[model samples]
Structures are given as structure tokens and as C-alpha cells.
Target chain A: MADDIKILAFDVFGTVVDWHRSIMDEVRSMHLDVDADQFALAWRAGYMPAMQKVMSGELGWTLIDDLHRMILDDLLVRFGVTQLSEEQKRHLNKAWHRLGAWPDTVAGLRRLKQRYTICTLSNGNIGLLTNMAKQAGLPWDCVLSAEVFQKYKPDPATYLGVAKIFDVEPGQVMLVAAHQDDLAHARACGLKTAYIERPLEYGASQVKDVSPHPDNTFHARDLEQLAGLLRC
Target chain B: MADDIKILAFDVFGTVVDWHRSIMDEVRSMHLDVDADQFALAWRAGYMPAMQKVMSGELGWTLIDDLHRMILDDLLVRFGVTQLSEEQKRHLNKAWHRLGAWPDTVAGLRRLKQRYTICTLSNGNIGLLTNMAKQAGLPWDCVLSAEVFQKYKPDPATYLGVAKIFDVEPGQVMLVAAHQDDLAHARACGLKTAYIERPLEYGASQVKDVSPHPDNTFHARDLEQLAGLLRC
Candidate 1:
């Protein structure tokens, strides 16, 4: 596996960082009189539908940062949180930049870095990724984003963009993600796939029945385990 | 200077990596029966003129990787090195991907990372910068290339593109380079400028007197000195 794989492109939000927990914590700290868990869930819930609009051409080319802000604005209106000022809302929208990594992310990425060129092939914009790296200490060799390709995930362009960025055959670059859809899309584009189990990605309260079965080229409980499996 | 700089977009070739020394070493190792220093110098001398052709509309938009290869191929013919194989030439063309960083680059970048988001704003294509970071341990948070903007450096789009990526004002991003021409171009586009003295960027025998002039917002001897001046 080490000999075959040259680049490891990661799905950042839930796979590398615990975005749900991070958002919930920020909501709690702000004391917005809102359900922190509900706010986190609501924020993530906006992500897919927002991306779908762009993917389906209902919306023009929009960055994840702008999409996130739009969703935040809608969600705030829905929740009737009228007490917050514009500056507070703006700061709250940037909570995505302060996400904490999953427990195994740093160690696993560090281990994998010894053998592979590790990068973020995330839907998150470059600024978000850069700020998150500084906040969380994710040691990516480079941060490759959907923003770079001007396309969202699940698009062939996004998957193929990773291979193009490294100037490698699609087979040489592997997409590591917790989401099966992302892995399947990458596989469709001829990239190797690694499935990581982040069962609590959404939140601990939500029951996610992710199989430990090896559906992809590799399967591991966490990034550290994946690194060990890859013999990094 | 530090307060104003929200993003620090770097010039990769001479500013981040020691291209002259690296190419010279590779040439020496190949034992190609040519003057290694002269070969390296000649190869670099072609860079600006090659970029100028594109910038002036005399040539179509071509990536720096292709531009480097064009220069390399012409140099090979000029030097009468007819013995090289196609595979060797391909490897030689990728020398830009294996450049050695100046001693202070990684350390200074780590420091700068604390204060501002660091990214590459190079004419080199995305593949070249990504591969180079993997090989040379450049700790870039994000890699932005002319490839993304479809325009080479000294183009206002490339300088302004860096600020656009971070959603910052043009005045908030600093262009750091060893070349005064690049700094001047960036400043003309309303970006902050920092000049570093890389007197040996052309080659050892060539005495490059890049003085620390007042034109640049900050001028330093090396990345370490620049980091100190930026208070990073």
C-alpha cells in the first residue's frame, strides 16, 4: 500500500475535524440562548442542500465560505435569534475556521506524512482550511479544496482535481473520508479509497450505523489506525 | 507591517527555495559534460523573458512548468547535450519539483504562520508547488499558483487573487520575494511588499547586489530576519 500510494487527500470537515462538536462549543460560549447541539446540527444540515443547489446549477459558482454564511443567516432567522448583533453573527459564522481535530487526526496524519504526501481535498475553502490548520495543528503538505477547482465534492472535477494537482495518475492518489458517497465518487474517478469510521461525526446523540466492513481499498477506525494499516 | 498583513503570499522559486544551487547540484550529479553553474544560470535567465512573452501577449498562456521545460529543451540543444534520453529529459524537467529550501524557510514560515496565513503565489503550476512542498518540507498553509488565476506573476490578477482567496482587502496581503521586480509589481497592485536578500539566487559566481531598499515595506537578509521583522 505504501509503495502504491503517493498522495493521501483527506476529507476535512467531519473526517479530520469534529465540526459538530466545535460548532456546538462555539454556540455554547456565545450564550445565544439556543440549543448548542441543535445549532451545530442545523449548520451542518445547511451544507448539503446548499452544495446541491450549486451542483444542480440552481446557483452560480459560490464558495463554501459564502454558502456557509448564507445558511447561517437563514438558520438564524429560522431560530428567531434576533438578539445577536451583526458583528456577533459575523464572528459566529467564522466558527467553521476554529474546528478541533478528531482525537486521532494529528498523530495519524503525522505518521502518514512520513510515507505519503498528505493534503486536504476538502469542500472547505482555502482560508477556512488555513485557519483550521493553525487552530487545530493539522500538518497538511498542501490544502487542496473544491474552491480551487471551483466545483463541489461528488463532482468528477473535484475528485480528478486532486490527481491533477499532484501530477499523478488517479490510481496513485487516495481519498480518505468517513462518508461513503465521497469515497464512491472518488472511486468512480479511478482514485483509490480509504473509509474512516467517524460514527459520531454528526453528534454523539445521533445513531449512525456505519459498518466496519472494508468496502473500499482500506478501512480503519481512525486516522492513526489507518496510518498503522498503511504501515506509515 | 504585521498588523496590516492578513495573508503572506510568497514567491516560491528564489524566495522559498534555492533553485540555483539545487539545479547546479543536479547538473553536477548528472555529469553531463557542461558547466553546471552556467547551465543553472542560463536556465534561470530564461525565466523572466519566457514569462514576459506570455505577459506581453506574444505567447499564449502557458504554465511555468511548461515554460521551464521549454527553456530546458532549448538549453539542452544550445549546450549540445545530445546524449540525454527522453526519460532523463522528463526527470530533468521536473527539477523544479525537487528544489532545496533555504535553511531558514521552514523555521521562518512556522513563525510567520503564527501571525498570518501563509501561501504560495508562484508562477509555477499547482503540481510543481505541491510536489515541491512534499519533497522539500515547505510548510505552506495553502498553495496558490498562477495556474489558479490562469495568469503569471506581475499580472495584477495574480497579486489581487491572493487577497481574494482569503477574502481580505489587497492592502492586507504581503508579497514576499527576493526579486525587486516582483515586489514592485505587487506593490503597484496595492499589495504590501517584503524583500529578502538572496544574493546567490542566480548562482554563486554571480554577485547579486539586492540591497534592502526603502521601497519595500520590509527588507530582510533571510526568512528568519523577515520573521523577526514581522514579529512572527
Candidate 2:
């Protein structure tokens, strides 16, 4: 069994908030003349490639807020919806801030917070995470971000930064993420890793293969299950 | 009127937690043969000079935790209490982490958090702030520290760092502190300032002549009053 973990750093987009459904709902509410699900998927599709540019040193440090805006601008043109004013586009880009939490998010976080310090170690910028926490009622002890280190997730700096913030060895901090790649990177940095199965993170029609993999220290179906497994 | 402050960055020591009383209580609990109040005051008197060393570039950036330890060592000798082992000294030095919040702190913070994104802009390092928040049930949206900025409080970078973290303009963020110097420094950096008077911050019988000088945008008796003044 793992020793007592002092800190639990979470991935925000899928694990804490249901980004897929929330983005789709926002697209639908905007009454944009396009497939909301497709729009959501297309926008998310731009995420990894954008981070790869920075990760590969092809681009200088860029925050998730700016990247989100860039993707939103391209997405608006791709969806053939040019009626949005600059102000409206700005507001639309902030949809990430208003994303709803997953069903298990609040209760699980509350339980986990009882036993350990919980924080967000997401690729999301600090501003975005802070706003999301306020909007979604997620009880984070701190909203740490890649923005603090000027690097994105899967980078050693971002993973190690969490440990540094809490002044603990990396082994004492656990990364709770939905993505295998993120957990893998954190594990490589000597941090404990938990893989949370956000099966429908892509959308309902796209059923994810939720088969267990052996790379992580803990695996759970949702935040609630993760909390239970952590004995919180 | 202040233009819809979204983030409230608080000063921690005397604002959120009663450090004087907490330290005195801890010293008393240890049954140390010394005046608890005097011991507490002596330890706190070391705080400013230590922070000034970093602020004035005399000392390379040092965290409050380490500063506290340095002062703790001298204080032990000054009080002629050499009975504590090294491990015991270390544990006792971390009393700052377990400080009890003022009566209205938790409830007021909860209320403020309903409307504004609340965080700690403390000279305390992230580790100390995180542990203190966990112990005291202070529901912070994030814990921004001087450690993050690599500069202590009253520094423009530390004050502006809070604004930068939230990607908001300085004027849109408010610094809630009990100290006049801290508020003045924040105001100089264009951040809104609120002074919460903690009359007995030092100790009840010590006769602290706290002047209600009008240097800040708002002044209140305590966190509860501050919450009401902010209409949170």
C-alpha cells in the first residue's frame, strides 16, 4: 500500500468537470447553426496539438486561456458562424470557466479534502481554474496550474511544481487524472498516480474503452470511487 | 464604488488566524517555563527583520517557514529552554501550520467566497498556507504565496502577482489585511485594499494602540464585518 499521501493534485477538464457535456451544452445554448457535439469534439481535438507545440519548444510559453481563445476563433470559422461580435467571442471563450462539475466531483472532493490537501494541477491557466472552482463549488485547497511553471501538463516541471508548492517529495503527492498520458508523465516524475475512468469524456455516442491498465497506483470509475479507494 | 471585485486576496497571520494567541496556547500546552505572551511577542518581533532581509536583497529569497525556524532557534536559547530535541523543535516550529482561525474567519470566508474568488496573498510559503488552511477549514479558492513570486509581501510583485494569477487588472482585486503597511503597499500597486481591524492581535493585556487610520478603501472590525461591508 502507498504511504500516506499528503497532497492530491487533480486534472480538471474531464476528471473534475464534465467538459464534453458542458461544452456541448454551451454550444447548443448559443444556438449556433452546427452540431453541438461535433463542435465540442472538434474544439477539444485542438487541445493536445496546441500543447504539443509548446512541449516541443516550437512555441514559447502560452497559457491555456490564450490557447483556448485561438481554438475558439478557428472553431467559429470552421462552424461557419461569424455573427459573434468580438465581445461575444470573448464571453464564449470563457465557457470553460462555467463548466459544470461531474456528479461525484463535489462530494468526492469534500471527502478527500478531509484527509489530504486537494488541488488542481491542470493545464488550465490559474484564472480559468479559479473561475471554474468558484462557479462549480469545487473545494480545492489551492488551484495550482501549469501557468505557475509556464509549462503545460505532462511536463516534469508541472508535475514537480505541485510537490514543490506543498514542500513535499514528489512521491508524497498523487496525480489524479483521467488521461493515461498525464498519469504516465507524473509517474515518471516519481509522483504517485491515479487513473480515473472518465469514460464518456469524449461524448455519449463515443463510448470509451474503460478497460483497466496497470500503469497507475490506483484506478477508479469516478471521483467518488477514487475517494472511497483512498479511504477518504 | 469599487468595481465588482472578483478576487479577494487576504493577509494570513493575524487576519485569518490568530497567530499570537495560537502560539501562546501552544507554548502553554508545552508547559514551557516562560511567559507565553512575551514568548509569542518575542518570536513575532523577529518576523519583520527576517522578511526585510529578503525584501531588501540582503538575503536570497527565503520562505517564512525557514525564517520561522531561524527565529525559533534563537528564541529557544533566549528563553533558556534547551530541553526540546531537534525533532521536537521542528514540530513546535510548525505550530504556525496548526493555528486556529478567529471566530468569524471561517464563516466570513465562506460568505465572501459565495461572490468573490477568495485566496491568501500571504508572506507564508505555500506549504505553510496549505497546511494552515487544511487545519483551520479556511476555504480558499487558491493559496498565492510570496514563495510563488519569490518575494515577500509589501513587494509590488507579490501584490501584483495575485492580480496576474487571476488574469485580472490590479484595480479589480482587493487585498484584505489587518496591517496598514500591507494595504498601503497594495494600494500603491493599484489593487483595492480593505483593512480589517484586529484590535487584540498582539494579546489582550498588551494594550495595542491600533489606530483606525483611513488609508484603505474599506475598513471593518473583523472578517464578518468585512463580509457585510462587501455585501458578500
Q: Which candidate achieves the best TM-score against the true structure?
A: 1
Relative to the unseen true structure, what is the C-alpha lDDT of residue A97 in candidate 1, on a scale of 0 to 100? 91
What is candidate 2's lDDT per residue for B209-230, written digit by digit as tens? 5577676889888889988988
lDDT of 1 by residue, A1-232 (tens): 5578899999998899999999999999998788989989999999999999999999998988889999999998888888888889889989999999998999999999988988899989988898899889998888888888888888899889888777789999999999998999999899999999998998988956778545599988999999989987
Residue B90 of model 1, lDDT score = 87
| Backbone steric clashes in candidate 2, count | 0
Error of 2 at A151 (Å): 2.7
Model 1 alpha-carbon miss at residue B71, Å: 1.8
Superposed model 2: Cα runs more than 4 Å off: none
lDDT of 1 by residue, B46-132 (tens): 999999999999999887888889999999999999989988998988988999999999999989988888899998998899889
Off by over 4 Å in 1: B56-60
Share of true Cα-Cα contacts across chains kept by each model: 0.81, 0.90
Which candidate has the top score in lDDT? 1
CAPRI quality band, candidate 1: medium
| lDDT comparing candidate 2 with the true structure | 0.88
True lDDT of residue A155, candidate 1 = 87
Q: How close is candidate 2 to the true structure, as a TM-score?
A: 0.95
